[model samples]
Target: MKNLGARTGFLITLGLVSLCLAPCQAQTQGSGTKSTTASAIFPNGEKGSAQTFTGTVWVQNLVATDSIYQLASGSVTFEPGARSFWHSHPSGQILLVTDGVGYHQLKGEPRQTIRKGDVVKCPPKIPHWHGASADSPMTHIHIVPNTEKGIVNWLQAVTDAEYHGAR
Candidate 1:
């Protein structure tokens, strides 16, 4: 029964993530007579575990690492004030911000505000943390390259003092 409760909570969180990420608008270029928008609505893969994140977070894995591709990718959405634990990738990770506002901080550096259309590069083996700001949710596409060397190294959870310290 305890396990079922936990799963239920995760499902509720997943529902919130889906609601936030499910909206998309079509844009017609030049001619109203043509449906010219080329947009893809990605599948919402899974709910992030409480072990890995605080609050509600969603991940949609789009690519799996293979001999040919050598890269793995997924889209992540953070609910307002939600954030990931301190972690690092072995071969580095790239974040393509797609919506709303967020905060990112490399270990020992100040927090930086991130917004839609921003691209953030997290250097290999460097500890960092990222999440949605207090006032807004955030969504980003994360690309991790060179998986043979390994992927992320999860560290400690970001303390409230650390998260609220964002500038």
Candidate 2:
């Protein structure tokens, strides 16, 4: 009876181990879709592993609407000295800073230093831009919506002269 119990325990442990490994395998293989070498080269968490571009880069189609209301959310990572072009939202937008330091400015207002844990609201139709400072990388989640006339209207990039002006 003791030997039988030991065998059962060993089998259970093996089963648990396999279960734990299965998810990791699935993640590495992706959602059965094509995966690039870049994903394999850098796992989820690696310093400077995120794709960096000179211009603005956003995660597309991250949000969806439900039966009741729409949900829109996206992640934007700004490299040092990178900022978005002037833009406004038809229904406004919200930002939740997730990493590093940055700045946000609304039309006709002084730039404000934004840090991790800060939540910023951009009023409807107010032109603005937010991005990493000249010396640091920044990351934030942008939440907006799909509306009748669309949520955002993007315009020209923020000029260097405009960005460096006194805050």
Candidate 3:
């Protein structure tokens, strides 16, 4: 019985030691890897062009790749009443809302309200448009993956009639 108690005590101590060291090991193990620096911060982004968006919008390009399985990512800020032209990605796109209120609508579908923490996934070649609501500005992180054939195909602008038709 004494030997069994000793064994159990030894095992408990070993477990406690492992738990204490695990986080320290994790912290130190990645020290040799390249550390992220201030260079990661991207400054002011470019203004959205009239050819691509209906109203004032700013885009900050975060990543663009030309290699296999091409990808592009950016943060887009839309002013109140601003929106993208109807468009579709050759591959697919993801929108992660970061702030404020917005709208997303697929072709032939009713506009859907989107807010912070909402994630919108648009399938390849599916026509869609997204923008800030008329009363609020909005920001979202847009990620496009598999861009080997290029990224977007812009169509007609969304008309006021369409925008107000959301139910």
Candidate 4:
């Protein structure tokens, strides 16, 4: 009889905990059309875990949502000799290099080596690409404005010839 009573009490406690959490979960997913401000209504949740691809590259998307224009922010890690495709943003981009060395270039200009503590801004509608150098991995935070039209407009892949062409 004592064991039965203990089992019943445990089940009741579990039910109560579930009931408490259900509302919070629902609010997180279904708080749309509320009059509350965006920041007040939606607190920034924790960023998702890092994802590393087969190449020595990793990315963590910090923010990407339908209703936000502050844009999609992410951290990109590039392996030595790895680079992104030639790309441009509708509203420009900002990059902060956190570690190692890399290269960045706007089209029609010389590529520049980027080191730690460097902050780069690619002007709106400019064609540019950034990535790890031939001998060092580079990590940078990328910020691109989110737009109702499109955030990123990708062009051809960054050719190895272009990546290694000049300083």
Candidate 5:
């Protein structure tokens, strides 16, 4: 009787594990016509230019537009005290926080602290900047939808006073 109970418990656990992994497997497998696992992974990102950023920042392109979608996405990493210059997306932007702590601020507004798992939506043409906090490195996935106008409009750099004020 005890052996039967143990076998039942093991089966239940195995079923639960399979259920948990099913979605992941499905995502990689895709439909018979298409494979979703065709996306490329960039381990080391390219350095962000100093002209548009402060300190050290790296960006890795993840997904680029195809015939079906006019969107581009990338993972950006910011070192301590690093940040992007004020900019805006023509069609809007989404930032998905993946690690560490950071800050986001819209023009003329107070800075907001952002941590892992936070999702920030910046409306179309709304000037803003985001970056790692003064003491920590931060990483986020940035999604920008391409519009007829363009993806982004670069603006002035965030002043040192502004960055320090957030801390």
Candidate 6:
């Protein structure tokens, strides 16, 4: 537990600091109400393609993967019930849940409920999927390392059964 606080509290502080420093944009729902976002720091970047996501999803690119750093950072926001297709990272990925309730599952493992201040470390090459819960929106900052080997290998979408079934 030595670095647990660092991973959670310090990370949150850092995120907030970055959020204040980064350019941000307002997000409005179809109903015209202001909505909380995935990375409150960055603006809603691009809408995730239907092939890569189930429902409405927004992805904001932060740090671009470059040869020198070989890393990528981004924030993803999911509307209620939105989720990504099953995917794997060549190296690995870390998820910092900044807001709302959500689910994360690795292939063959029971799903885990995640919320604000939670940190999820996904192992290399492990197939997994994550998104907002049925009734709540969610957002997380994803940090991918070792991008020189490739970032992610996207697979099939998580079926409704796979997503809504028992944890």
Q: Could you say which candidate leads in lDDT? A: 6
User: C-alpha displacement of 59 in model 2, angstroms?
Assistant: 3.2
Stretches > 4 Å off in candidate 4: 1-55
Comparing 5 with 6 on TM-score, the higher-scoring candidate is 6
Q: Residue-wise lDDT of candidate 4 within 55-120, one digit each (tens)? A: 345566766745746578877777677777777888899998876789999999988889878999
Clashing pairs in 4: none
Off by over 4 Å in 1: 1-41
lDDT of 6 at 54: 100
For residues 68-144, what per-residue lDDT tens digits would candidate 1 score against the true structure?
A: 88899998888889999999999999999887789999999988999989999999999999999987878888999
lDDT by residue for model 5 (47-116), tens: 9999899998888888876646788889988888999999999999999988778999988889999998
Instruction: Report lDDT (CA) for all predictions.
Output: 0.84, 0.70, 0.84, 0.72, 0.84, 0.89
Model 5 lDDT vs. the true structure?
A: 0.84
What clash count does candidate 6 reach?
Answer: 0
Which 10 residues in a row give candidate 2 its minimum summed lDDT? 41-50
In model 3, what lDDT does residue 117 have? 88
What's the CA error at residue 113 for candidate 6, in Å?
0.4
Error of 4 at 20 (Å): 40
Q: Model 3 shows how many backbone clashes?
A: 0
Looking at candidate 1, what is the lDDT of residue 81? 90
Put down candidate 3 lDDT per residue, 64-164, tens digits, no spaces: 77696489999888888899999999987999988778899988889999998899999899999999988877788899998887799999999997787
* TM-score against native, each model: 0.75, 0.62, 0.72, 0.63, 0.73, 0.77
On lDDT, the stronger of 1 and 5 is 1
Alpha-carbon RMSD, each predicted model:
17.3, 8.1, 9.5, 13.8, 9.1, 12.0
Model 2 / residue 112 / CA error / Å: 1.0
Model 5 TM-score on a 0 to 1 scale: 0.73
